[model samples]
Each structure stands twice: as structure tokens, then as C-alpha cells.
Target chain A: MVSTVTTSLADVASSNAALRAFLHGLPGVDRVGADQRAAMLGTRSIKTTAKAQAIDLAISMVDLTTLEGADTPGKVRAMSTKAMHPGEGAPRVAAVCVYPDLVHVAVETLKGSGVKVASVSTAFPSGRSSLEVKVSDTALAVAAGADEIDMVIDRGAFLSGDYLKVYEEIVAVKAACGDAHLKVILETGELATYDNVRRASWLAMIAGGDFIKTSTGKVQPAATLPVTLIMLEAVRDFRATTGTQIGVKPAGGIRTTKDAIKMLVLVNETVGDDWLSPDWFRLGASTLLNDLLMQRQKLTTGRYAGPDYFTLD
Target chain B: MTRLSVRKTYKLYIGGAFPRSESGRSYVVASSKGEFVANAARASRKDARDAVSAARKAFAGWSGATPYNRGQILYRVAEMLEGRRAQFAEEIGGGKKAAAEQVDAAVDRLVWYAGWSDKIASVHGSANPVAGPYFNLSTPEPSGVVAVVAPSDPFLGLISVIAPVIVTGNTCVVVCSSPMAAITFGEVLATSDLPGGVVNLLTGFQKELVPGLAAHMDVNGLDLTGVDDPELALKAEQDAAENLKRVIRPVAEDWTAEPGLERMTRFLETKTVWHPVGI
Candidate 1:
């Protein structure tokens, strides 16, 4: 009988351990700190072609930031039409990220592009205005023609330990978006830590952010390995908890194939197979396209293409 | 000719104990003279956690203290700051005159917040009119543990953000600017007798410490008044939302231009009570 009891206890212990492990494996459904998330991402191997494919797919779906003050509403509409030409091999750009005022331009520009128009609101690079004005700015951007509103949170609020206010504002902004997607920019460069980055990512997701983007490209220390890792973990955890696959966008400083590949590796390792698709991933960069195109050409012909080979325009 | 020896090391301030950053990583601390002072610790999430725990533990006594009593303590802090005015002026970025003005402003703001502690309910609070003969009143209360990314520059920015939060009874885990003035502020906090954990100071990059506080579940709020980057501010705001914590965004106005009593008042939640009136 004693031996039988010991066997039963051992069985129970094994099952308990298994259960705990399974629970831990579930993606955390909340914002995680940058450092902790980075450590987890770092633990996994960077080798995975599947990860690279996911990143490629994500890049393809991006709304590519291509406005240079020359984007009139008509011009933007024309570009959107071309982007969504839907030829035999034509794929869609995820969304078109544009200046806050130009959101309507992109909206009218890609009215039928099937591509979402994302407007950079909240005073863009400097969120120094009053809350009333910021909220109004987001509302106006949404009303103008944006299918998605990219709103910058008040950094001052985040630094002051007034997180609820920030979260509430995002929620309000998300409500303001109506049917439009809400992509929240963390500007990871100014945030300074993988832990904070993870936290910011989680916060944005919970506050109804459709996508969590890194940096405005205007700040120093744009995007880094550790910061990206934290954001990926946040997405993974958010998906596991809510059964919702939130999107990830690493903006600023991502201008090369190598950088894109690294971020892809981070996402795949942290979030697993489900998130390896365009719907859940995106790249917010201006210069990254040329590098990616160059890499793609090299892969196809096994020869380095000169900068002129691809029309940068 | 005599050779001048240079020192390299940053010490962490915990419960009045000056130790190296627990991470064992030390970064350069430059002074106004362009000289390196000491290498400070690169505080980690663990250190931030410890600091938060310390602040949470200390909140009961600190927040529970009578408003008059709290005011006296703040007054004492002002007094001490006044005495050390010259030292702070020298350490803060602006020239002596500018720094002195900043110090004075900070002292005045501290006193201003101190006075508000006992009387905020009257100034910023109100009674609601109900359909029935019911009395409803709302008064502001502390939001508990706050994680602050202090200004990277110093003096006015730092004091402007930090004082308002604590004056209203919230304990703070502040990540002071990378170098210089932070150490001096730590000295000011050390001598203030404002309770051990009521204001825990961590000297490091705002980028490094903010994430730790943002992700910590125990932290009730975040203040990103010093972070200049719009994207980072948005991210920090987003992260704070994960836990539904209170967040205060950065404003463009000069913090020193006027007393930011509203900033402090904004962080407070008005808890209203209702009772039926009998004839």
C-alpha cells in the first residue's frame, strides 16, 4: 500500500509539472517589459527560413511610407491604384502610412486600393500639445479618410507614471477610429529599455491598438534588437490571452535585409507559427524597400544588382 | 607637476545605502565642467522591482500621514533645499543664476504642493446634484506607486515632474537623468527625511528604467513628462495601458513657467460618496 501511494504521488507530481509547463507556454496576454522580453527572444535560435518568409510576407503587406510633400490627394490615389493593381502576381501593401494632414490624401488616393490608409496623428514627432487638441487631431485624421490611425502617445504621461490616462486616451482614439485600424507608435528609441518597450507594446495592444510600431525615426537610438524582441513577446502574449493575433511593426532604423531578417527571427521564435503571416506583421520604413528589393534580386540571379537596377521612385 | 587622478564608478542609492547598480554595469557620469564624476550602476528590472516594492511598502505611512504633517515635511525639504541652493545651482545644467532660479522655483512648487495636500478636496473637488435628496461628493485620492522617467536635462524639468506626484501622497520610483544633477537630487532626497521609500531614486537612462516600471504589475501609474520623443512617449503610454495604469503625457509648456498644481491634481481620482437626505 505504501508503494502504491508513492506511485500515485509521483504520477500526480508529473501531471502537475506538465500542467504548469503548458500554462507557462501560453502566450502572455499583456504588455511585457523590454528587458525580460528581450531575454526570452535572445534565448531562441535566429535560424529559421519560416521566420524569414513571415517577415517577407509582412513586408509585402506594408502600407509603405512614400509621401514626400508631393503626395496630392489625386497623386496618392493614383499610387494606391497602382499598388493594388491586382495583376496575376500583384500583392497588396498592408496600409499607406502618411502625414496626419495627408491621411485624407492617402484615403482618397487608395479609395479602391483595398489597402488601408494610416495617418500619423498626435502631432507626429513631437506630442507636446494639449490632450484636447491631440484627441481632436486623431478624430480629424480618422474623419478625413484614414482607414487606420497611427497615434503617438504622450511620452510625458508615460514617464510620469500616469499610464491609465495614456491607456484611456488610446482607447478613446481607437473609438474615434470607428472602422479604421489603430496603430500605436511607441517610439522605442526614446523609451530606452526592452522592458519598457514590451510594456508599451502590451499597453498599446490592450488599449485597442491594432498594431504596435517602433520609433518615429526622428529620435536617436531608433530600433534595436532588444527593443524589437520585447515588442514581439508582447504580441505573442496578447494573442495567447485574447486569441487575437495583434500586428507588429518595427519602424525607424530598419533599412537593410539583415535588420529585417533579425526582427523576423525575433517574431517567429517568440510568437510561434501562427503569427508568421502578413496579417500579423509589418515594416514601417522608408529606406527598407530598396535594400529588400536588392536582396530579392540577388537571391533570384545570384548576382549583386547595382542601386540603379531598381527604380527607387 | 602633480597629476590629477580620475574616478570612474556610479553608486546606486537604496534605502539610504549607496551601492553600485545591481546589474554591475557602470556608465559614465559627466559634470558641467566636462569632467567625469563617478560611474553609476545600470539599474535593471530587478532593481526597479525592488525599488517599487520599497515604495509600495512605504506608501501606507506616507500617504496616511495627516496633510498638515505632510506639509511640515515638505516645508522641511524646502528649507533644506534652500540651504543647499548654491550646491544645486552649481550642479544643475544652466549657469549659477539660472540654476538658482530653478532651485527657487522647485522649492516654491514643493511648498505649493505641500499646502495643497490638506486642502485639495476643497479646491479641485465638488458635490454633485442628484435627482433625489441625496448628497454626493468627490474628493481626490492618491493613485499609489508611481514610476517616473525624470527629465534627461535636469533641475526645472526634474523637479517640475517629481514634486507634484509625491506631494499628493504617491510614492515614486524615479529614474533620474543619466548623470550630474540626479546625484545632487539624491543628496537632497537623502537629507529630506521624507521617509525611506516614499521617493526611491534610480540614476540611469530614462530608456532603461521606464520599461521596468511600465511592465511591473504592482506599479499603479507612469509619468513621462521628461521623454522628448513622441514615439517613445506613445509607447510608454501604450505599455502603461496594459495594466490600465494611470499615465500623464508630456506637455510642451515650460514646467518652470508656472506652478503645475493641475498636473498633480490630474493624477488624483475623485472618490464620490452618496447619502440620502432626510426631512
Candidate 2:
């Protein structure tokens, strides 16, 4: 995998003041327009061949996530194995997402299987810890063989208009990731408005986020279509301007095959087909994988299967 | 001066909310005298799917509730039904005396099943004498979401079929033949303490909706009590077997009579668990 655009992040914003100015200078989002666009894209009928393909593609794009405080090594291993071999002939998930401490367990289980290990660090779900602890959290996961680092932005800082604190924190976490691809979670639900979501997307991108994510799966209204659409638009617009492509991942509450297909439609229409791959897009979901597997089975077999047939990791 | 009477639009009950069929299709229901009653929401395949989704979502909570709690809820349904006796009697379209009897039987049937809610497990479950040093226990559990093709008798049959399915904590999506009476029944459910989605009532042709419910992978059990035609019942059974769904065959019966626990037990799955007796 190519390194994240970390070096140029410094070039884009030489100082904290410069980063703040750049984020604020970005255009505001029209909430109604974003919602309308999301609803319009959601109505796209993907059936038969396109649906079958989309189901498989969506399955492959999943960052099968389990970020509970009670997650054990055994649970991580089971989830990793599930990620690698969801079902017979079904494509493996893009990665297995877990808390920072369980990265090694996932790494050991997923060894040689090609599924990456993504660890959420930097006091994930709420970036309230000091920069020292957050950096060490990222460094620990990286040293433990995590292939990707999903860090949460300080919503407290972002909401308080301290854009510099949130930007520098993302940059610091990205650097701590070393070569591991950095996915910056905006926690868009806590951002309160679509305009804040739009600004956070640009902030994470300009500060060297290889992927801009919508949530930590910890908040209500997480990873909604309209919120995700704004991030997709940000990546599309950012790619057009800077010749650098940043991926988009919508996490949480996307549990059905139907929901995943709608997100795929959003990506297809918003960023075109370029962002459809696992490298460019991901669905940070846990329950969604089983539904996708069920739909895939329905397409292949001519008969429907039950949840009893699928293993829940 | 003239006074105009207000009539209610009989709509499908899904996920606790009354929604017109997604297809926006409706059918007219006329009385035996050939007078127009009301325009009922003619639900399609999509509505069946939606109702199944709702029933499936409600299954976890309803099935997991304490049996005592379930008994209380079922008894509450009986109480609500009793309070709406006049409305249900009027909707049944017969003379007040016969309709009143049907309504009373329906309410009594609910109370009867409500008493079985906590007792069914004890009656059905057993502790087996195992060959090894283990405690082997078998119990019955609600078999997820059930799809009911309610019998033609709108009042008593509807209550009889639905009461048994829900008494043991299995949520249901019912396709009713009498749309007007079903909608009036829905008002009682809404007013009762029962949770939304516990029992979704749909008014449409069973031929149009049954196929979708039968074929839905999420629905675990099917009650074909209303299907009198052999061919339709056979087709529904075949479609239901796509997921190996547990099916209750349609039987000609009197709904007003004393219902045995068979209807309640038919929708249940037996689960046996073994644990070590000693350290």
C-alpha cells in the first residue's frame, strides 16, 4: 500500500493557524440539498446482475468491526477468521476492526489471509485524552502490526471552533501511524450540522487522512447517507483540486443489504466508479456482513437461507 | 339541515403505524347485503415484506420477555377487546346478538390463551434422565416471527389465531380477509399495552401477500389457518419450505369452541440443553 500524503499535509498547512484558515475557508454545506441528493441516490434500483455484484462488492468493502470494551482475544480471533472466510466462496472482508489492544490477536489470526487489521486508537469514540497518550495509542497499534489506524477527532475541540486542535491532532495521529493507512473518523453525528461535517471532511483530508470516515459507531445518527454523501463529495472535490484521492467509509447503523446498496449507489453517482473498491471505500459495520452474505447466497443458490446457517462472530 | 356521518379509512397496520399500502392500491369491501362498507388498503408483496421486517424486529423483545409479562399483555388484549365489543360487533355486520356472542367468544379466547402463557413451558418442557452425569433439560421457545393467514370469520377466528401465536411470545404479521373488522381490531391493539410490531395486521388479498410472507427468509413459522383451497395451501407450503419454515396446516374448525393448547404449541420450537451435574 502507498503511504498516506503526510509530507504534503505539512506543505498544505505550515502551522496550526494555516490549517484553521484552510478549514474555515472551505464552503458551507446546504443541509436540504444534501438530504435531497442522498434520498434521490437512495432510490436507484440495483437488481439482478448489478445487485449480485454490488452485494459481493459491499461485502469485500466491509471493515468488520467490534469495538467493545469487553472484546477479548478469543472474540477478536473469531471475528478475524469470520472476516477472512465469511462463507464458502464469499469474498473476505477488507479488514477486521477492533480496539487497539486486540490488534495483535487479529493480526495473528488473519496472518497470510490478506485481510488487514484495523485498530481504533487515539482514545477512539471520544478523543478526550492528551496528545501524548493518543500518539502512544497509535504507535502501540502500529507496532503490534495493525495495517490501518482509525482515529477519532476531538468533537469537543471541533465543536468549540478550535479547528487547529482537531487538525493537528489528526496530523499527529497520522504521523504516529507511520506507514499504516490512516482513517480519520469525523464522528459526524456529534458535529451537529452538515456544514460542520463538510468542514471536518476537508480538515481530515488536508491534514493527511488517507480515508475520511463518518462515525465511530458510538453515536446516534452515525454514518447516515446524507452525512456520508457530504464526505464523498469532499473526497471527490478534493481529488479534483489536489490530484489526490481520499477514500470514504460510513460506519454504524448500516445493517442491511439494502442499506449497503444505497451507500454503493451514493458512491457510484457522487464519486463515480473510482471509489467503489476496498482501497477507496469501506463500510465500517459488523451486522451488515451477515446480511450481505445472505443476499449473496440468495443470488447464487436459487433459494433463501436463514440466519441460523451463518456463523455470528 | 342535514348531518353527514364520518367513516374511517381502513388501513394496514405495520410496525405499529397505519400506512396505506406502498403500492397505493386499495379494494372495496361490501356487506353481504351488497352495500359498500369501506375502502380497505389492498396490500401487495411489498407490504408483506415490510410487515415481516417489523415482526422480525419485534420478535427479539417479545420472545425474550418474561412469560408472566407476556400473559399480562395477552390479558390486556382481552380487556381491550372487551371494551370495544360494540365496535367489533357492528363491524362483523350481523345482528347485534350474534356479533355480541362472537365478540365475547373472542375476548374469552384471549383470556384463555393468556393463562397458558406462563404454563405452556411447564406443560411442554421436561427434564430427561440422562445416561451420563449431566442434567438434561428440554424447553419450548417461540419460533421467531410467524405469518398468519387468518380464517374468514373476522372477529373470533382472527383473535383465536393471533392469540395463540402471541401468547407464547411469538410476534406475528397477519393477513386478514375482513379488512374493516381487522382495522377496528387494530385500534384496540394500539390502545392496549402491547408493543408496536408485536402483531401487524394487513388487509389485502391473501393470494397477493401470502407468497411474499411464505417466501420471506426472515419469517420462521407460517399459520395457514385461513387457506381453505387445497391448491393455494399447497403452493404456500411449498414456498414456505424455501427456508424450511415451520408450517401449521390449515384445518376446518370452529373458532368459538374451547381452543386446546395445540395452536399455542404448534408455533414453538423445542430446545434441549445439557449441563454437567457435578464438578
Backbone atom clashes (below 3 Å) for every candidate? 58, 0
Tens digits of per-residue lDDT, candidate 2, A1-313, equal 0133323555546766766666666677888899998999898889999998999899999999998888999999899989989988989999999988888899999999999999999988788899999999999999999999999999998888887888889889998999999999999889888888988998898788999999999899998999999998989888877789999999999999999999999998899989989999999999999989988887886445567778876
- What value does the lDDT take at residue B56 in candidate 1? 86
lDDT score for residue A235 of model 1: 73
**Which stretches of candidate 2 lie above 4 Å from their native place?**
A1-12, A300-305, B1-5, B33-35, B60-69, B115-142, B239-246, B268-279
Candidate 2's error at A200, in angstroms? 2.2
On TM-score, the candidate that comes out on top is 2
Off by over 4 Å in 1: A1-313, B1-10, B31-34
- For model 2, residues B26-52, the per-residue Cα lDDT tens digits are 998989999887899999887887788
Top model number, DockQ: 2
Q: Provide the TM-score for each candidate, comma-separated.
A: 0.46, 0.88
- CA lDDT scores, all candidates in order: 0.70, 0.88
Q: Tens digits of per-residue lDDT for model 1 on B1-279?
A: 898986434466665556667777767776767887666777776577678768888888988988778778887888888888887787675566777888898888777777877887787778988898888888788888888877776577777777788877888888876555666666677788788888877877766677657756667889887777777788778877866779878766576576646778766877898888983
